[model samples]
Target: MSQQSSKPEAPKSGGWIKPAVEYGPIVLFFISYKIWGLMPATAVLVAASVAATIVGYLRAGRLPWAPIITTAIVVVFGLLTLIFHDDTFIKMKPTVVYTLFAATLWGGLLLKKPLMERLMGTSLKMDHAGWRKLEARFALFCAGMAVLNEVVWRTQTENFWVNFKFGSIFLTFLFMATQLPMIKRHMLPDPAESESKGAAGE
Candidate 1:
């Protein structure tokens, strides 16, 4: 059987496209909130999330599970918000999604699946042990995000929570960047080069 490559290349399309698609809905939601307030913004968020999901699947030929799940929750809670005429449902969406992510990642680690390895392996190329460690850290981060969202939405204003959502994206990017050194340390050496060196040494 042929072994799969540890490092897989990203799609040939522009790298910026992925981030644009991922964040487009959130940006739209933020803008809608600023202009029309929370109710209209919630509607816009649901619509934008649907559009983003459709665009993402069309580009990649597969829906990314995390965004899809979050989108679904947004739709659900969004509908509830409209039905009850209460913003609480929409505000709770982030907390729910973040908690789900934390539980899912930690559960995967316990099951020996290590979700980060599956999700990021294409770009990161870390060994199993490294994947486990990364997964654990990510789980903790997700949990922290969940707690932070809960605290903010409950104790702060709607506008503050909205800003937090936007600012948290950058925080997450920084966290991911910080892990590069660890990922580099645990990456597997190139098999072809290793074999060549061994042959040369003999």
Candidate 2:
């Protein structure tokens, strides 16, 4: 779910490394799909996804759950698609992933645990109520995405679905942009500032 790290550094020279390593395989898969076809694309995606995960592990010293889980599903569904000569399995990967994410988030809430908090707590300091609201909204959002993916793949052409898959990044960015205001509202006050104010009050 989260990439564990000993030290985090912003690359000064190879600033493009992270994005390249992350998205290169996806771009390759898309290109392969257009040139080759469904089964070839599935094969290409499985190979590229695994390569990406290896790159990530070599860079970060561990496999982050997001990519690892994604790669696993890709391998499973991709192999099924290849073996069965059916593209249906490959088309359903996003739905399966989104559903799993939604269930995990909601299930964590039911267990009185905030899974996202464990993953992102160091970066985002929010109160209990804030975290609950954020998690609930994100869970619903993922569920909606699952349904939307199913609708698109079921009703549309494969080419259209492929375009939608890439274009969905814009929608995701817009959604996150809209959450900036809410994030600001729920941001916890700096502890050092609070301590300084308390000392001054005395």
Candidate 3:
């Protein structure tokens, strides 16, 4: 075979690409709203979502499911907000998104497919028990987030809600940090090392 044929395949988009696209729109939305207002911010968010999707596809050679879903939601709700000139549609976006996540997670568990395991199993090496427990925790956390958004949007000022939208990213990181210990404890054992230890014992 030619050396060219033996060359490694190019890697797809990962790491910073995912989070930056996911959260960058929210940050821009907050800034836009602070400077202009909700309608304009919503427009900026919708545009950003579309741009992020295109960027992801251009870099990765295929569209990612998360960004596609996010773009769809943003475009739909953003249009609704602009059409009606009401903030209600945009404000309920987080609640709807989180509720969908919670529902998807629970449905996956019901179908005997752990949600997190299916989504992150490639990157996260954890035993079945860990995956199951992590899935449950994530589902619960999503539900909590939905409820929290409902409360905040229904009770707080528009400015506060915008701030909370940005703050939610921080909350997500905090939640993951809390799971580090559990994840480490439940990581899959090293098979080769285990076998070596068993051979030594024998």
What does candidate 1's lDDT look like per residue over 7-45, in tens digits?
A: 232344325446755678788889999999999999998
Candidate ordering by TM-score (highest first)? 3, 1, 2
What TM-scores do the predictions have? 0.87, 0.83, 0.87
Query: Model 1, poorest ten-residue lDDT window?
Result: 1-10
| Clash statistics: count for each candidate | 0, 0, 0
Residue 182, candidate 3: C-alpha displacement in angstroms? 0.5
Cα-based lDDT for every prediction:
0.84, 0.78, 0.85
Q: Name the candidate, 2 or 3, with the larger TM-score value.
A: 3
lDDT of 2 by residue, 120-154 (tens): 67667987777777788889988998999999999
Q: Which ten residues in a row have the lowest lDDT in candidate 2?
A: 6-15
- Which parts of model 3 have CA positions greater than 4 angstroms off? 1-12, 190-202
Off by over 4 Å in 1: 1-18, 192-202
